[model samples]
Target: MTHILQIDSSPRLERSHSRALASAFLEQWKPYHPGAIITHRDLVRDPVPYLDATWITAKFTAAAAIALSDELVDEFLAADCYVLSAPMYNFGIPAVLKSYIDYIVRPKRTFAVTENGFKGLITHKKMILVQARGSDFRYGSAYASMNFQEPYLKTVFGFIGITDIEVINANRLNTELRDQELAAARTTIQALAATW
Candidate 1:
């Protein structure tokens, strides 16, 4: 059976665009694959703690000490696909999502430094990033060059072998173009859900 891991990092509930898009995607996707198993991780509700001294020491010392990290990595590795929803905060992703990444991206867990440079242990997975931005940051826009979310997310996930990344950016949410942009994003999400 296909296993899907759905992660939502947006702190907002009713007004969260990214979270709604993610739900819309899932709503459309479920019909296509009815038996797919799904796991939900809401970072806002159950926040993953930032890496502390013990967690840092555990990375190089005893494997057993890294219990939480191991659990996070194992959960990540168990999924065949992932739907990650987050809002761009100060040109980057939310702190909760970043903390979750820190927990999972362990040295010998998700990746490793090998003779060939860096090796990503997690393989053969696809990811859909449902991102909500406050301004117009799409390519060619004046503020496009200022976006730090996409590049950082792709790089970090790519480091762990998830190279097939698709992004659905709902930009200009804080402007008059909010309705138009949100509708366009919904349309895109619906189309992608049918195929991806």
Candidate 2:
């Protein structure tokens, strides 16, 4: 059976578009891929603490850091697939999610520095990012360059060796077509359920 890890980062529950998208995806994906085990980690309710000075010290000392980040790193590696809900906060990912990333992106655990540069310890895993944004940041949009959520995620997860990534964006939620766009996203998710 396939294992899936879902991490939701939104501070809001019902009002979060990203969370809604993730929930819909799960509801739709289950029937297509039966017996798929799923795990949940809510960043809002059980936020990953920020890396303090001692945590930084522990990071450099492999043995010490393992105790601090091992659980998260191990959980991350154990998953065959990931579904992440990433809402834009000031043009980038939320602080909670960033903190979570800092904990899991440890050296030697998720990546290694080698003579050839860097090698990712994680491989052959797939990731799907569900994003919520207020502005229109589509490919050719004026503010497209301002969007950092997907790019940064891809880079970080790619560095850790998860190269197969799909992104779903619920864009322009603060606009007049908020409901329309959300409905469109829902439709897209329904279709994706059958395929992805």
Candidate 3:
């Protein structure tokens, strides 16, 4: 059975655009594959600890010697697919999601430093990022250059060997164009759910 890890990173519960899109994606995708195991990680409710001195020490040390947070890494390694709902905060992803990424991307775990520079360890898995932004930052838009969320996420995930990443961006969420953008995002989510 396909195992999907659904991560909701938005602090907003009832009125979060990304959360709603992620829910719609999962609600639609589940029926396409019967008995798919869907694991939910509510980052806001149960925030992953930030990387600190102890965590850094453990990360640089040999895996067998240091006691690291294997549970988070293991969850990431076990998943076949991931559906992440992230909201843009000050032109970037929320801190909770970044913390979760820090936990998963470890040396000799998710990535490796090789003679050829760097290489990703995880392979053949797909990730769908449902992002909500308060402003317009789509490609070629005036504010596009200020967008640090999508590119940062793509790079981070790519560094860990997850290259098949798809982003459904709900931009201009705080503007008068909110409804139109959300409707388009929902349509994209439904379509991707059916195919992905």
TM-score of each: 0.97, 0.96, 0.95
Query: For model 2, what is the alpha-carbon lDDT of residue 101?
Result: 97
The candidate scoring highest on TM-score is 1
Kindly list the per-residue Cα lDDT of model 3 for residues 1-196, writing each as its tens digit: 9999999999998789999999988898889999999999899999977778766776787534234367888988889999989999988999999988888888888999999988999999999999999989999999898899999999999999999998898999999999999899889988898899
Q: Name the top lDDT candidate.
A: 1
> What is the per-residue lDDT of model 1 for residues 1-196, given as tens digits with 9 covering 90 to 100?
8899999999997789999999999989998998999999889989988888877887878556778788888888999999999999999999999999988887877889999899988899999999999898998999988999999999999999999998898999999999999999989988898899
Candidate 2 structure, TM-score to reference: 0.96
Model 1 residue runs over 4 Å out of place are none
In Å, residue 75's CA in model 1 sits off its true spot by 0.9
lDDT of 3 at 178: 96
Model 2 gets an lDDT of 0.90
lDDT of each: 0.91, 0.90, 0.89
Q: What's each prediction's clash count? A: 0, 0, 0
Off by over 4 Å in 2: none
* Per-residue lDDT over 57-97 for candidate 2, one digit per residue giving the tens place of the 0 to 100 score: 87887546446478998889889999999899998999999
